[model samples]
Target: MTESLRWIKSSYSDNGGQCIEWAPEHANTHGAVPVRDSKNPQGPALLFPAPQWSHFVEYARKQSV
Candidate 1:
């Protein structure tokens, strides 16, 4: 399922070790967001429901990191 996904990292990222990649295209069509650590492309990905992903993003955006 993940093999065909076109993963994309956040524009806000600095291309550092602490970065994640998500396939927005897939999420838009499937209603689930696929996310994985950028440093580990071959690793397992976590699939979150669209609403949950939105919440997670909102929370992360408000963090100090």
Candidate 2:
């Protein structure tokens, strides 16, 4: 799982300390989504299947910030 994984943070992320990081490479090849904190790259990542990730993004989009 450590090999061939390329992680990147959301472009909207700023130094204000709120950010989201994702492993797009893993998602493309394995159909599983990986999310983690920008502040803790070595921390545990939250893995979600493709469908679940889609639903989660949709739900989040509908909420007011």
The best candidate in terms of TM-score: 1
Q: Write the per-residue lDDT of candidate 2 for residues 1-65, one digit (tens) a residue.
A: 63356888766567677886888888888999988887887778889998899898789778936
RMSD of 1: 1.4
Candidate 2 backbone overlaps, count: 0
lDDT, model 1, position 63: 98
TM-score of predicted structure 1: 0.90
> In order, what lDDT does every prediction score?
0.93, 0.80
Give the runs in model 2 whose Cα sits over 4 Å from its true position: 2-4
Q: Which stretches of candidate 1 lie over 4 Å from their true place?
A: none
